[model samples]
Target: MSGRRGEAGSALVEVTWLAILLLVPLVYVVVGVFEVQRAAFASTAAARAAGRAFVLAADPAEAQQRARAAAAVAMSDQGVDGGAVVIGCRPACLVPGSVVEVQVSYQVPLPFLPDALGRQAPSIRVHAEHTVPYGSFREDRS
Candidate 1:
């Protein structure tokens, strides 16, 4: 009977330790996944906003500037920073019926990671692309 009681106590302790060991990594993974998802959303918003800004601008130079600004705003709104916003035009930029493609890409660092891990800490890449077409009836001074 005494042996049984001791066994129960040790079993409880072992189980607790096991649970803690298992739980920590799970929590880490969940937090990392959430961060990656947030960055993904930020990138998506940046791409869409950039494409719209490009389409609305009067000329190529202004279009590029507006697109970058819009992309930065969108990413910053979600607490993300330093992502690339690239604009590519199809069939000539600013012309009626031209298509502009905006791409936003960034790296999301994993949670609970240390810089000592490497110069490039473990990270997830969040990327998004959006396309906006210049309105067929849209005419502006350039």
Candidate 2:
């Protein structure tokens, strides 16, 4: 009877330890998901701003410059100015009445968890792009 009692206690201890071990990974996954979501929002905003800038630009080169500046402003607003946001032309992309592509990219840092789980913090880079028609109505006109 004593031997059985001892075994039961050991089993409970093992279960508790296992639960604690699992909790770390669970928490990490939840936090990481939220961080990724925040980054996605930032990227989307940057892309939209870039697209708007391009649409307002007078020429291709000016469009590119505007795109970059717009993305920078968006990034700054989102508290992610340190991250990179790139704007590029797609072929003969900036013709009047054509579609202009704006790309926004950034690296998101995942905070470190405990080393007992043998997991290292991860930094993931994400990108978002948007295309807007060149002839769309401008804000100033409205």
Candidate 3:
């Protein structure tokens, strides 16, 4: 009876400790995963939006400007910083039947990590590429 009484509270204490130990890591992992997912979403949307903007622009200079602006907006909407957007065109840009490829890339810092860690901190890089085709019958602005 004395032994049972002593063991009664031991199980509760053990469980509480175990829960605290397990839950902290579990919560950290979940937050990291969510942040990476958000970055992925932002990159994908940025690439798609930038590609479309590039193809719709009236001039080469405007196309580049619009592509960057569109990509920045898309990334910002997902709570990510304005990332890099690189555009490449097939043969010639703003030409009929040409295809424009836009790539969006950014790094997702680990959950609860500070920038002071610099490159030493673990981070996940997310990249997305989208291609838009200028209509065959459209006027060539190149």
Best by TM-score: 3
Q: For model 2, what is the error of residue 142's alpha carbon versus the real structure, in angstroms, after optimal superposition?
A: 22
Candidate 1 residue-wise lDDT, 1-142, digit = tens: 8768757668788999999999999998888888999899999999999998888887889889999999999999999987988889888888777788999999998877788746867788888999888877878434
Q: Which ranges in model 2 have alpha carbons more than 4 Å from their true place?
A: 1-19, 58-62, 89-94, 113-121, 136-142
Give me the overall lDDT of model 3. 0.91
What TM-score would candidate 3 get against the native? 0.93
Error of 3 at 64 (Å): 0.5
Better of 1 and 3 by TM-score: 3
Q: What is the TM-score of each predicted model, taking all chains together?
A: 0.90, 0.65, 0.93
Task: Give every collision pair in model 1.
Answer: none
lDDT of 1 at 140: 45
* Lowest lDDT block of 10, candidate 3: 113-122
1-142, model 2: which lDDT tens digit per residue? Answer: 8768757668888999999999989998998888777788888988998888877777767777888888877877867755565655444555544566777778787756444467655578888988777663433221
After the best TM-score superposition of candidate 2, give how far the Cα of residue 139 lies from its true spot, in angstroms.
Answer: 15
Q: Worst ten-residue run, lDDT, model 2?
A: 133-142
Q: After superposition, how far is residue 135 of candidate 1 from its true place, in Å?
A: 1.7
RMSD of each: 1.7, 5.4, 1.6
lDDT, candidate 3, 1-142, per-residue tens: 8768767768889999999999999999999999999999999999999999898889999999999999999999999997888999998999999999998889888988766745667788999999999989999999
